[model samples]
Target: MQDNLYDCPEYPLLLILSGPSGVGKDTVARMLIERRPDSFYFVVTATTRPPRDNERDGLDYFFVNFDEFAHMIETNELLEYAIVYNDYKGIPKQQIRDALASGRDVILRVDVQGAATVRHLIPNAISVFLTTRTEGGLVRRLHQRKQDTQEGMALRTATARQEMKRLAEFDYCVVNPEGRPEVAVERVLSIIDAAHCRTHQEPVRL
Candidate 1:
């Protein structure tokens, strides 16, 4: 019926790209979407945290107040949500459903805790854990960010160390070295390609 194996239709994928705070999850997510804009849909997360000077409300994150976030939770509109570094963040359900319905691979950039919750909810979703090449590298990145106060930075560093121990929970561990995010993006693309070619692919349950 088909001309060749390449002609077979492939199912869309739900990919969770997660890591500790400073491992470049956002960078890698942006690169993936840039590389496959038509086939990939990046899920913008909604957060109760105040936006930074350079961040936009709908583009970088759906910046919401505590009341709005609570409303979303009450209405069961979020797919998975968690408090991170004293701020609430969540993935919206309808945007993901719409993207998957349109056959675009959905990508979610979340922290390690949120990733675990999403994996439990969507067992068939592919989860990738991103980390720097060395623990010291991660620490340096966290320190260099300077977005947080000294106490806040200390807390984030401690939390990141704890999150690193969660590497086993993910399907793949990617080393996103500093300033070389493109390499990590290439590896992620390869993973997506391999997933599409699996002989016994499990339909993502969402």
Candidate 2:
């Protein structure tokens, strides 16, 4: 029985990537998945927001009109959903179910609030919080974005300060240095690898 504990079978892990508004969570998630293409199921989030210049409808997010997104909410089809910057962002339950059922780890990139919600929904999920090296760096990154208005940027920066205090709720934290996404990706990859090596793992609920 003692030896059996060490022989635990590998199960598909549910890895969540979350962070402050301007912390590059999307960039790090994309890089990490591309690093190990065969090992992850990236859950594409559904959003009612318009697609950006470099964003693809289905790839970056399943861009839909408000009615379509609202329907998903009405049907309880989303794992988690939120109103962000006047836009609806959510994760589809079906994608995560299909991915885990097929024996692949799942990755979800969400904001800090969504992360906390996911923790309750999936207690065993391996949640990692990513942030910049300093507050000044984070503020600069937010300011550099083109689409957000001055008011919107100020709101995000304020929310980020509140979100930072919740880091203790996560399993691990990685600071992504300015302009250094590779470093963040490597840190997150290592955390996932370590989780799989644990003798007792939390079973992902969703």
Candidate 3:
């Protein structure tokens, strides 16, 4: 919890990447890490939602039941938490602190709502809102997921529209077109580089 931007480290930044569903936030972040595995640290969030096929605990997510999730919230173990589509999702506070202390830049792929909470908790964290080239493209991508029912899709689209209004809250925006995550990856890396090179910038005071 360092204050005074003058002493901030060039690396070990805690970045929050968020967007409405189907915007390919995860894909873009993955590509960025793949491009520099030694420099980026990916944090798997914790969730009350059950793991999908091939998903593993502590990897894809720290999958836990309602009781466990509640315990975390009660104990103030989560840096931020939100209920998305009726399931709980959160980022563990200690995990993020440990990652940053280890000297690796951390990337958190979080829901738009969860990201908002993180911005307050970590005032200096960089918030990037990822979006598709067009709103229609976002709808198409959500439909292609095949995991959502007709009702669920409708609900998601409505929620996404509401979420889009918060784009102004983010520090930066990156457009991730369908099937082209690398472009977004490079753009994000450039943002990080620019931030690091700035002579007078506030340090991330987490």
Candidate 4:
């Protein structure tokens, strides 16, 4: 009985959910946390970008000023940091360490660039690339936001196209169809389940 029980043991997973701008990465991550509240820990990213009206400081993002962001970088508090569209965005190292120590799977929602950095730091981490069904759909969604100027939109669209070509770097890619984030959430969960059942699961060390 003891030998049989040793055949399988669970190890916390570090799952990176990333994609190009305007692809529903945030939506999918939100639903994934809601679906498995107890088993998953959503990593709140730190950024210099100001929060929108509905976004909470720590909950939505760890909003900070440029100086403070620079201080974090100087002190090496970030697991991965990048200059994203003129703003500084990064993941806090402590949060991930604490969450993983608690035996909960950590979900990091980041841009494609940040994802690559994290993958390099934690090679065993599983990465999932979220994408729209088509490039046209992605552009349409960005335009629908109505928040960016024409030049800003054009830059984002061009960058997104380049990011799409990096899909082969990720372990899995999921299509997030318009208005259907739950479908993508289920797919992500399925991937986590499979990772746990791998024959030679390696413990994710920070």
Candidate 5:
């Protein structure tokens, strides 16, 4: 293993991963955390949406109600926040700072709008766009999830098309083809590895 030479007392690399709703962002993040839990810290977003059947409070999301979420925003505790389909979602500033202070690579999985917010807030941060190779593949995967009604699916598909147009704004784009999640994870890992080896040894000090 290669050593990080320019390692400061605390070096934090902020990576923002964004994709359309049904493009497997959570699945890819879970795989990375499972592979090397000690090396990376996955930031859990706070959301007003109630926990689903298998979702956990802190694991899947920091589930909060509307009033609590509103207080967080009013207190400026969130680095970035947005309303998605009537639910409020935000990333806490303290959680990100804590992760970075510990010299961990922090990965944030957010929507396209939230990712854009992060980019403006942290200009040096790395941004990646994840998408399916084809529209048909994306639709098929969404159908498999079985969580959306026909109308909901139509809305999501439309939103996905709009999200795809923002791909050019990202630093890197990874094509996540259908039924090949591991491949996508490996590709992202490879990108992270290369990023760490960049000629400029300075990590983004948040």
Candidate 6:
């Protein structure tokens, strides 16, 4: 066994979590924040979608309208942004930078496309791909949300199938089978622990 295993010294680490919609990405992220509130900072994404009931500004998302989103795109303020389900969603560079500089383990719950963009920008970032054991499970979870119509659910399922193909591109894959949110959270936490022990240069602060 290797001796003197490096202890991650409260340095900033960016953990990019991506997966198909309804694969429990948000659920896993929420658990992490709740379990280790001091150790991790959940990065809030900016979106053009109207906030749903019970969703608060700067919590669930940084809600914005179309015009503001378009202006952000024009100014290149977003590190990565994409139109998903006809709504603009993106990570703001300044928010990420600030979080990193503060030596917080910043976790981003983003789509596969946004994850890919983060990988390109921060090559050493830990990328975790969340997945469901089967397509049926994905469909079921989407339906449980009751936020989407039948047609919307169908579109999400179709999109999920396409996103699943990118699994190989991630560093690790965790299956949130049967919506076991705790299991998924543990798997991701294990990956984060393992990553901290690797012998690599410290990640760029922000």
TM-score of each: 0.95, 0.94, 0.91, 0.96, 0.92, 0.91
Best by TM-score: 4
Q: For model 4, how does the per-residue alpha-carbon lDDT over 1-206 read when each residue is reduced to its tens digit?
A: 34555568679999999999999887888888899899999999999998877789998899999999999999999998999999999999999999999999999999999999999999999999999999999999999877789999999999999999999999999999898888888999999999999877778876
lDDT of each: 0.92, 0.89, 0.86, 0.93, 0.88, 0.87
Model 3 agreement with the true structure over 95-162: per-residue lDDT tens digits:
77777777778899998988888888788788899998888999999999887889999999999999
Error of 4 at 99 (Å): 0.5
True-structure lDDT of candidate 4: 0.93
> Model 6 compared with the native: what TM-score?
0.91
TM-score of 2: 0.94
Cα misplacement distance, residue 101 of candidate 5 (Å): 0.8
Q: Which lDDT tens digits does candidate 2 get at residues 120-165?
A: 9988899999988899999899888766888988899999999999
Candidate 5 lDDT score relative to the true structure: 0.88
Candidate 3 ranges beyond 4 A from true positions: 1-11, 201-203
Candidate numbers, best lDDT first, in rank order: 4, 1, 2, 5, 6, 3
Give a tens-digit lDDT track for model 1, residues 7-44: 45578999999999999998899999999999999999
Candidate 1 — which pairs collide?
Answer: none
lDDT of 6 at 46: 93
Structure candidate 3, residue pairs in collision: none
The digit string of per-residue lDDT tens for model 5 on 172-191 reads 99988677889999999998
